[model samples]
Target: MSLLNGIFPKMKMTRSSNQSTIVSLADKEYKKDRPLVKMCGITSARDAAKAAEAGANFIGMIFWPDSKRSIPLPIAKEISRKRWFLAGGVNHMNVCEALSILRPHGIDVSSGICGPDGIQKDELQILSFMKAVHSVHY
Candidate 1:
């Protein structure tokens, strides 16, 4: 708590389930000099990059099970970068194509990199999958 002592009265980005954007409840002193913006439910890096490009100071990764925008861990990590966020039916077999054609903000995976039970993440599959993505030129 001491870390935030001087900056304790910080503003917060409030959100609701059905919304894609964040609303910062200010403390009157909030200035346009660098308003804090957190782009929520970012599913790709492109979107994140775009948000960053637009002056967003932070990002929110969506992973709520019942929320329509819930993203898989692998995909979230992928987009947690600067650009490109791709999802929907992506897997090892087709990741290369997605990267070559679509490009990264990052890829979201569930069954694509999961074990047989479709719950636990398969490490080798995750590695191989990210390797395939990283191998792409652009």
Candidate 2:
């Protein structure tokens, strides 16, 4: 087996001790305070549906071919039917163009937010994008 495969024990349920079980329950209650948004790049539609059912506010569907999370627009459209936010590749230079087409509730961008390897947002670009969206009637 591959090193990654061996390390993860595919689809195996974690055996939680009593203390761990109590911690998990407590964590669930704590998470109720703020809506958590999860970006799933490695999950199938069924798994994404489960996340939606569990109260995820956003579900990302990668459209960048270079990413392992990349999925076709058709599949993304199909899986994005639930109430959760649907967002895909909003990092490319043509992101605004794509947004015009997909019309997702919100767009997510990381690399596009800054220079390569940078950790912060490019304030000017961010403001421009936000302003543009605000100008739109929808």
Candidate 3:
């Protein structure tokens, strides 16, 4: 089975160390909160829907073909109701223009947010990217 399918099983049973069982996502009830969250590297619509139902503020669909997590535009478009960001190769240089065109609720980045090593996440780079994103009205 695919990673997405495994992550979003129809019914999941979790047993705690105390031997208490936790209800599945389908059976659990929740009180909503206002924190905005985004699920990145989603490859399937089913997973996207599950993320939306679980209260994600945004879902990320990586469009860069080079990334293993990339999802096709058609599949990404199939997911609706929840705001989503297109990630992969997104950086400060093109973020504003991409935001203006895509108009997603937010954007996501992995490599673009990394430091000189191109792997480790850079706090300063992330902050700068956020500032750039916030500067755009839309």
TM-score to native of every candidate shown: 0.41, 0.57, 0.51
Model 2 lDDT tens row, 82-117? 233334445535565655555655666665556544
lDDT at residue 30 of model 1 (Cα atoms):
37
Clashes by residue pair, model 3: none
Better of 1 and 2 by lDDT: 1
Candidate maximizing lDDT = 3
Per-residue lDDT, model 1, residue 23, is 27
Identify the runs in model 3 with alpha carbons over 4 angstroms from their true place: 1-38, 43-47, 50-58, 72-82, 120-124
Residues 1-138 of candidate 3: C-alpha lDDT, one tens digit per residue = 342223222223344588643323332222233334667887775676566567664567777778888766566555432356678878877778766655665566788889999889999989988887888894
How many pairs in model 3 have backbone atoms within 3 A of each other, for residues 3 or more apart or on separate chains, i.e. clashes?
0
lDDT of each: 0.58, 0.51, 0.63
lDDT of 1 by residue, 26-118 (tens): 233334455445566766656665665565545566554566777776766555433434555567777787566544445566777888888
| Residue 78 of model 2, lDDT score | 54
